[model samples]
Target: MSLSRTAMLLALVLSGAQAGQTVVAIRGEDFLINGKPTLEGRTWRKHDVEGLLPNSRMVQGIFDDLNPETARQWAYPDTGTWDAERNTREFVAAMKAWREHGLLAFTLNLQGGSPQGYSKNQPWHNSAFDESGVLREAYLVRLKAILDEADRLGMAVILGYFYFGQDEHLKDEAAVIHATDAATDWIVKRGYRHVLVEINNECDVRYDHAILKPERVHELIDRVKRRSAEAGVPLLASTSYGGGSLPGPKVVKAADFLLLHGNGVKGPEAIRSMVERTRKMEGYRGQPIVFNEDDHFDFEMENNHFTAATAAGASWGYFDFRMKDEGFAEGFQSVPVDWSISSERKKGFFRLLAEMSGEGK
Candidate 1:
């Protein structure tokens, strides 16, 4: 076959692969892309990530609105009706812009949790799964659009399957399992390469459902892995802890990768200590470590969250929640996300990421 035809055929084969399939692999301590080392010469405890250090964010509310009560919802005015074309276009544009600035991954939640407490009457139950345990078609379409765009932009997505607050919307643990199976099967069928699975966001949070609680969280992680295996997809899976707490030994052993949060950590030394401490655990085997959610905003400080994480040889993610201020843009976390790099926090993060990843040049 001609080179063009050969490339086209290879693409078709890849596009048809199962979800959770081995799109990204761990090769001796480095993450491998198409059998080649990525994030060259950088390794945490002698193991390097296959691709770029994922400069990720918890952008759960980007595609959907946060407040269901208001007529003019956060993301778009028409909350009930899904605008496939406009939604995809804006999401793709945002992903492209972030990628150009060296952001390689994002942490998106299927069921987003509210940072504000439940008593505040927050609409924290916005979820992709309905009560009947079916993944919403509209949500799936939006997810596919983002994943497709991420693949095209050479970026990855850390897709969170459940959130504690909204998980109650499901009837029971079996329904949760059914939802998991269905979602994973769909992902497998779609054959997305640049995606990772986070079984639950902050598993330590107080979940109404017993199955999703902290003590039994590893079971769900295992369940996701089993679903992937059964579907012939190689899914990398992990669950996160709440702010200031390290994952227990069970989670550490169960997860394919270690995810740590630095929200309440005081300084860079504390961050370094956490990473070092995790490495010293008994079952620890030098899996790739990432600080996937940290809300510390000491951007100009010397020992800020970003500097602390990178210095300790771990990948980092930014988590900033912002309420709508009259003069400010909504790119930062919280509701009504601008989706553009409008806030100083977003700009500074991308700038620093570009500089660190050598994409700035």
Candidate 2:
């Protein structure tokens, strides 16, 4: 095996030594899988994650795009029934490319909300739950495929369980809880150590269902942890906020690691301030903090976010979406994602990541 792969396997083995089950653990601002520090011996701090890329809403259209009508037609296509063969192929390909370019983490949503306000026929509403409340078999198959590929590639997946706008489709709060239990149970049964659970994409966002509103989101996080404990799987769990907001004290205390967003953050200074303010929150326990979603543009400004985040000893994530006039040229966050290392933005981000993390030398 290659050195990176060997190191990853060793880490998994070490972390799973206790219960003989692969798991991810939080240890003082670092993420450990099978007891070995992730991105170890890199330029950044011992447990800091440096190569997060812009892959928000990946699960939304990944399968739907296979439909004949949508087949690469729209910017974000949605035209077909879920096809396991093609979905797995495309997902694995994108993931492999990401791993090759030093991206160790990406965000995926089970139910993707509309970036533009919700519409009657939003193509990206391909949620994992069906109208009857059971987990969609097709979604589970694709999810497992992605998780399995992530485990093999030594990468981690920040799996968001729900998204705004589309979450109301579920039958009720009982359905939501059942879905959570089912998802967590499946992960534990499969022994995946590279998955982190985000109960909702942005807990503070408007939701038709009261169960998932910001006030009670902490309960979902707790449920995830409890279910993992029941299954004997050590999983990392947290929820994210909308841009320019910090999680509430209940959320701060519930999450194993803190997840922040940069949607409306003004610049690097704002990013730094948010990180600092979060660290000083009433219930803050000094867990690893990460900006898993941000849409700020420009190389200098983007660099400012990265620099500020790393300087504050926090991790950062890139958020890009496809706009009408601008093709995918900017670094990190552009839309109609090629998923390959095709854009200058992707190349620049990976190159900077290599320098920052001391990987791909």
Candidate 3:
């Protein structure tokens, strides 16, 4: 095929592939889907619920272990075999439940999070980008399935490109950059309007390359924004920080929305405090402050992280990981996840989400 003809055909194919179902955008401190504010005009206990995005960290939705040694570890209890397709299939099937419970968003990483939750070392190779930074088709196929479903349901996806533990899988700085460019191109060409690009999971964590670190990670955020802008897709981009840490001045300025984590934060009051302190930072210009990952949950209480964040005009996300004795139905980040709202903890979070989002109405 002629080069120009090939390019034209590619554009047509890409345009027809997904059909651009949902559109997510930021307007000052609010999130808008399809030109209207999220949860428009709603209030939860005197807090303005309009424009806030309630989310959860479900990073392993497209998870797969390439290392033979570790691949066997995620085997289902019933099947006694690990199946990446089944993992994503189950994840897709569970999305409606989450959406019905008033979840407007969820985080899914290209390089999946540590199946062990918090680990000093990650031996499993679970990245969607190869060492040379090329996109893996198998992973993208699964991700497309999830993103397509989220689009149909009007849910926004905080699509993350790299996780700290998995970023080391890329060979060097160039590979990281290549991976970012490639991922950005793919998302843009796919015509997904519901996707928010998170350049990396936590910029403050230990990363193999300096560019992916906190000081310079904003460069990648800007890169994604630039590339997407050139393509006319214009994805909203940001990188997150470690638990309870405030975003730096550089990212606060570059990012379209500020992403926060509440894992290391101690209490509900601390959660409220983090949101308060973030607004006072140098480059903060009233962008939507969203906690896309927080392991805390006290849904039955009078006040908790969720309550506190909403009260402070910030959005909150639930990060559930199965404890040592917990079963399949426990954690959303753990491998071989039971994506259903099965356990008490999962129920508590969704129950509160439903009540607040007025899904229970």
Candidate 4:
């Protein structure tokens, strides 16, 4: 076996994680997998890559639309049909390649993000929770399979519980709270140590529920932490803000780590400034700052969102969506995704990732 593989196995054993499971922990501003810093001892271009969790946004990995009317929209070209099982199978098959390309983590949402990448109005019913905030068994089964695979590969999952576009699925605030507690309970029961809880994607975005909004979102975050701690699993939890905005005092104080987005932010300098401003925000603590959903990418450039975030001591994530006139091979967020490392855009991101994470060497 390779030395890295041996070390990973040893780490898993030492950390008391079950066989074929990944354990994620936070140490100050560093992210640790099985008690060891991610990208251990690695640096790129005078930037400290060690301890950073390089990730991407793959929110729709196990996506399925419960609404049959809209389900047909995500049909694969080859099969001319939409199969959630096939989508998940292909997603799992591509994960090892993603890991090989130096991706340590990715974001997944139960209520998936916009299938159109950035939709103004979401008419599709795509939620894992029912109107009562109970998780559907079908979705849980698929989620378990994905989480199991992520564990076996030694990768961390930033598992998001809600998304703005799909929040209407839950009936009310009570249901939202129930979903949060239920999700947390499910994760604990499943014995997943490598999962971080993202309460909602972009809490400041349009949401039907007030509990999911920025001011009160921390209540859910604190609830997740409390519920998980009571269960003895103690999962790390947080919520993210919209692009270029600083996290409010509540989230800043309550979150285990800060999650940011670069979707609407412009330029590398702006990215750096966002990170800087976050660090100085009220109730700011020295937790790891992560940009888990950034749509900007200029991988070949000396400075970009990825580079700028890293230089400012924040981990960055790639959020690629199907742009106008792009084919299936282009975007990870677009429906009917080609999960392989196909297309120039995909190759560019992974190529730079490999170089930065020392995977190429």
Among these predictions, the greatest lDDT belongs to: 3
Candidate that scores best on TM-score: 3
Q: For each candidate in the order shown, give its overall lDDT on alpha carbons.
A: 0.67, 0.66, 0.90, 0.88
Q: Compared with the true structure, what per-residue lDDT tens digits does model 2 show for residues 315-337? A: 77766655555553432222234
Q: Would you estimate the TM-scores of all the predictions? A: 0.83, 0.81, 0.95, 0.94
TM-score of 2: 0.81
Worst 10 residues of 1 by lDDT: 9-18
- Identify the superior model by TM-score, candidate 2 or candidate 4: 4
Candidate 1 runs further than 4 Å off: 1-22, 42-52, 61-88, 115-121, 323-328
For residue 198, give model 4's deviation from the true position in Å. 0.3
Cα deviation of 86, candidate 3, in Å: 0.2
- Stretches off by above 4 angstroms in model 3 are 1-18
Per-residue lDDT tens digits for candidate 3, residues 1-361, read: 2434423423321223344879999998999999999999899888889999999999999899989998998999999998787777788888888999999999999998989888899999999999999998777767777888898889999999998888889999999999999999999997889999998888889888999998999999999999999999999999999998999999999999999999988999999899999999998889999999999887999899999999999999999998999888898998889999999999999999999999943
TM value for model 3: 0.95
Per TM-score, what order, best first?
3, 4, 1, 2
lDDT tens digits by residue: candidate 1, 148-201: 666666666788888776787889888888888887888877776566788888
Candidate 2 ranges beyond 4 A from true positions: 1-22, 44-88, 113-124, 300-303, 327-337
Clash pairs for candidate 4? none
